[model samples]
Target: MTTRHQLALGACTVTVAALTSTLLVTPDGATAATGPDRIHDIQGDHRISPYAGDSVADVPGIVTGVRTEGSAGFWMQDPRGDDSPATSEGVFVFTDAKPPVQPGDEVRVSGQVSEYVPGGADSGNQSVTQLTDPTVDVRSSDQPLPEARELNAGTVPETYAPQGDPAEDDSIDGLRLRPDRYALDRYESLEGMNVQVEDTRVVGPSSEYDDLWVTVRPDEHPTARGGTLYGSYASQNPGRLKVTSLAPSEEGFPAADVGDQLTGTTAGPLDYDQHGGYHLAARELGTLRDSGPSPERTRPQRDGELAVATYNVENLAPDDDATKYERLAQGVVRNLATPDILALEEVQDDSGAQDDGTVTSERTVGKLIDAISEAGGPRYEWRGIAPRDGQDGGQPGGNIRSGFLFNPERVSFTDRPGGDATTATEVVQRDGQATLSHSPGRITPNDPAWKDSRKPLAGEFRFRSEPVIVVANHFSSKGGDQPLHGSTQPPKRSSEKQRHQQARQVNAFVQDIQDVRRKADVVVLGDLNDFDFSATTSALTENDALRGAAATLPEEERYTYVFQGNSQVLDQTLVSPGVSRFDYDIVHTNAEYADQVSDHDPQVLRFRP
Candidate 1:
């Protein structure tokens, strides 16, 4: 249950690049006193700075942007206008020695007007009024680019969190940022200034430094393939930002995907970073076009019925990635129409993450059943239990477990024995019905709410003749929780009591098989990282013995994953009551379409037994 868009780049790519400045301006025609004390009087009206620690000198404005890489610096801006929408006529002139300045020039600078706060001063970060060691004087050089600040369309700010009060663990929300109802307080009322955004679409996907995440108002949360539908939080669509990229060696940035737009008018400056929060460091880039058709769905076949998918294949093993095991067997045969009975979460093993333990994934389930019989589907026949080699955590030699894949010509696998792997799958009652003697086994796996976690497994098929079973799960992750917007407020989900006691011990082993057989057709699905409006899914559907198949869609299509833009539901499936209704959907293929294969967005269900 850990698919938080797994691209894994721990950090270091927030650069919006253009910071060059060797302080040059000292030419003799000198001038040092401008007047209305400009650069928005050291960017005040709040957010630190009444001249910070003062050393003030001449302050004028007009450089507009430079950044010769890493933390170099330049960004001025004072064409005029002080009606103060919480003052911010842009600043940042901290220099290094002295020499080359361009973009509109007109300078002045001086030194020591600090207020910096980048990663210091108690580090909750976000301060930057800068001017340190500065020198500059230029007073003139092609002064044109200034009327920029355009964020258009309905003036943004529909709240993305900040109902005030709540702050601490990693922090946020000590309130007072109402810069007009949120969008991170209207980007902290023009923090660091100089902005733009026009027609910027692209909803996240070109990373490894080409950075992305646009939407300069592509009609806010519009879904159905046009991108941007992460809903809830009072429609906070301050017209998406985060674009970062420093001319990646000139002309090499176009792998975009979602609703793709980025062609012109992106401007830049507004920074406030800790890795993607109010970013726009984009000095100028547009032209991506291709508004895609790849948000595809429709493939949950119904004829000759038997579907059941679950896919958290984000970590499949067998020497891993061979084109993501042929693009997850073309999303399990052209997008899940081949789910005879899948489940397969994380998988791994056969030397994948190299933890030296070598727990089996049977060549990672024989390269996804030989790439789902070379993508024409059906050859399946798999089963799992593994663990004990690494107590079931994940990615350390890739021992990830939870599995079962079927289509033995449409179900059968009774396996009847105790399928080991450190044991647990009970609820016997042989002739009284119920089942699971060890079909695929591993449930309580030496309890302690199943230690390092991933122990659910079960399986015991038979389909049409009735008696299904399933289970699968890959729980225990909210990876250290506490985030739904910080400073704690309502955050602190510190792994919701170990996923609410692993959903009450998988609801007491599914109430010990519907109290020893009572129409037992169960399911339970994968990646239950919690949410279906969580409480760890009300301890797995509390009084109802199991339910959520995304509570049956609608409520704006009950999500499958999305993060940052919300469409929340950490992959579900549940079922059980009358055991019938399992015709589920969510095959939106890969969490919000990136250059995808799996960050999990798969889920089929379908039933006709």
Candidate 2:
């Protein structure tokens, strides 16, 4: 199985510096058009989405709400009781373009109006319309640009009443707007132009593409599908914009926060990676360093005990050897670093034409396996992989494509029926409810490519007659900094809902194992891609399903990843409820692990079954 380490939490810290913009609003002594005299204040609790009408054009309203996502993303309500969701399409343009705005900062906005239409099956937040804004001050009414696009239902009108200079270029601040026509063209002609586009949500390649997948919970609303849009960019071509720099929208809601400013100048060059119809890029990146590797390389490596570890290598690629990742595995295994069982993420299936007549779908995995055997970890063998067949023809599919590496001597593979984790008898019951066996949990089968990605690696083994189960996984990560499950966005209770789904899947799997074998030992390992303190982890641990190893370490040593200029733990290893019977220790060596080619520091947990 291929091990893919996510770089989101690691790279998110580069945003400490501000990427500011200057707006030169034309001096027009503008007065409000006589309309219904309705005033909305953002100081109190008034849901702003349904009213803001998915656009950031010059719609008049007070700074009713200010949500600081990375920069500042908030909502604006009109004096006429018109409360709509703010988006890049219309008057809803990001101000400061950073996040987490101060509660009561007043500002003015001017731009075209637009709406958000969920792509039929594409991965991404709502596509936005064009809007222009210059100045925002702490004050009364905001002005509207004469020609903002209007959303009639979910459809956008081709033409608008062009006000101002008609030929003024419809610029936001000083950035020249690039129309959807340009993007749909995939930058054929607009390639090297410093054009600015409103609501252009730049993103990195999917996990399978560049080791990142943002988690977005589908809404409870009948139409919601329970996840964020999945996309990928080309490895050969990359984007110039720093996508990780843009903040994510809040949990469930699909609109930008009112007054949300997303301003990133298109610095020449555009590279696109489209596996299906999804387009993404991974270029123009910024890096930061975390804790160094551990000094003690030989961490309690014994014969009978099981040494386990998990790390998000942030997408470990063969520096020079592409046909096989012998070197990649060498860095991880040679220093007596091999664990009895290693769960890996971002294992790519062979994509290129059948060169040299290799039939293996995953060259990376093959290389790693050979390298391990070449090293002392020769006893380890292949176990099972999740989503075994989902593949977008070898293109980057979901951000998570995980598998497992096992040592046959430590344990022998046992038989277990194959199916989704939600159906297992031992799985945790959905939150606030009991399972009826009659009513199975919800399972939205992902794209075929997703099948190739996003599945847990499961295997059974016996350590001296004691049956042990290992489930390796790589859950989704947080996308842009928008708050989907907050007081302001849609689906006010989205954050918890996502946690419940992930929790449900994990719980069910654990339960299944328990049901089949009484008192069996279970070890769950992989790059959860989520922090240990998050609601997702809370849900998984709430049932007391597994015992965490990091909890044994100090707060400073507990973290495995960093974000928002802060460090936190995301990679972890948890044992089933029976963990109290064994003694365990967690040794993080990513700093030292970095000395190799990988970014994630491998964590070592030595324990007795």
Candidate 3:
């Protein structure tokens, strides 16, 4: 599976300077003011700190939490604060190492006020206000910690963020925070403060990175399986919060799945990171109560039904663990019910990610076929053209490509010569039927749209003596897109431009086949890496050439992927008008589970062609 980027918490040495009551020196060698007497004064009513870049001395607070790992620091909150809800009373002291303090120790800190932007400034993320290069003086120990502000459904706002100023490139940095109106502003207003949520539901499954996502408001765009549905760009769910433990690794983070509930209060400092923006670094972790949500299985295809399915077995290789291969095989056999034709994406080369000159996936596909047979499925045959070395834009040297697996007992793959990696396939008329000139060929392999990306593989199949054209695609990923909680409003999706071009090319290919024979039965399926309601899907289904099967389901059940607490649709199956009578299902065997074989849920479309 493709693991997303995370915040790298590195260690730094904390320098202890001699304690002095005199005014401190700033980075510009200027004498700084010593009186920002309260934490609320330092953290003004805006996102950026009012006293940034100046050194302040003797800022007193009670240590709310002590983080001993990853840029070791402590969070302190002033008990006595001005009666302004817009300004927070807590601040983080970046000591660069383990500070000599406990959770309840009252102390005075001297440091330079700075705005450290998570993921750097170019990432367009919001800056976190911090006190860096500190000199700490422990006044007393065992004092009471500040009361954590409770964050619940009623406390969080319905709107996600404020409309950014267009003159400043739609940036929300300079705007005054309105904690009552918008969610982002509320999170910013409580930025390094101690916060808590009671009886929260886990909307996103626990990832491998020892973190999980929970929602303060459970009813926001809820899925049937207890996940927040990210239906549209306008309804970005505002109550989602990522949770990571401040306890040691031996304490064990919860292995939570969707529908699991954090029974008690999960309290921590509200911190910002590069991965998911505002998250709670939990000091007082909650207990997990599993709601017993299991994986879902789709109904098997009936007689006279041609079932086609698509699964992105994330970066599958030959040398992977046998348990992974077995689980995947079981998902295909037991959960998917052995579809007549399965389109597999991310089938890596035989060497996996090793940077050799190898460009074949025989061992990879052969191992999966053996596993399926071992798991009581048919001995399916496979067909795919390998891409040139280092051309595809997956992990380097993986040579990830799409392939088709068909059951010979139910369907036959029509094999034709001259189908290779760089050869573009054409639609031809044969015996008053539309067929591919080269079966298992690529769709415009040399086109600039497919540059450094997986080319769509097209193959012909004969089921019940009827020819069906299938196109398997793994489009460009959304690696470079801006995040939802980023500084820019509406978030720039620059990666969609390439997917749009790819969709247009594939749509034109389907149109060409229809031109050859107007009633051709064509099925296009795979990980399109775009949403069903997005422009990419629109371009692929334009002019009524194809219809997105995902759109046929209810709005709440339309997702096949879960990303950052939002259930969405990234895998899709679109069919031509000739195959109008069909039953479609997105099998929820994965994506919602913490122990998943693949990151995406497989989608199946059964029809009589």
Best by TM-score, which number? 3
Over the stretch 48-131, how does candidate 1's per-residue lDDT look in tens digits? Answer: 567675655556678776766666666778878588676778876756422356668777665556665554544344456677
Q: Which 10 consecutive positions of candidate 2 have the poorest summed lDDT?
A: 215-224
Stretches off by above 4 angstroms in model 3 are 1-20, 26-30, 248-251
For lDDT, the strongest prediction is 3
Per-residue error at 322 for model 3, in Å? 0.5
lDDT of 3 by residue, 145-261 (tens): 788999988889999999998998888888998999999999988888889999999988899988899999988999888899998889899999999988845757778898899
TM-scores, each model vs. reference: 0.36, 0.46, 0.96
Q: Ten-residue segment with the worst summed lDDT in candidate 3? A: 6-15
Better of 1 and 2 by TM-score: 2
Q: What is the lDDT of residue 34 in candidate 1?
A: 28
Worst lDDT run of 10 residues, candidate 1, spans 6-15
Cα lDDT for residue 357, candidate 2: 27
- Descending-TM-score candidate ranking: 3, 2, 1
> Cα lDDT of all candidates, in order?
0.70, 0.38, 0.89
- Return the lDDT, model 2, position 169: 29
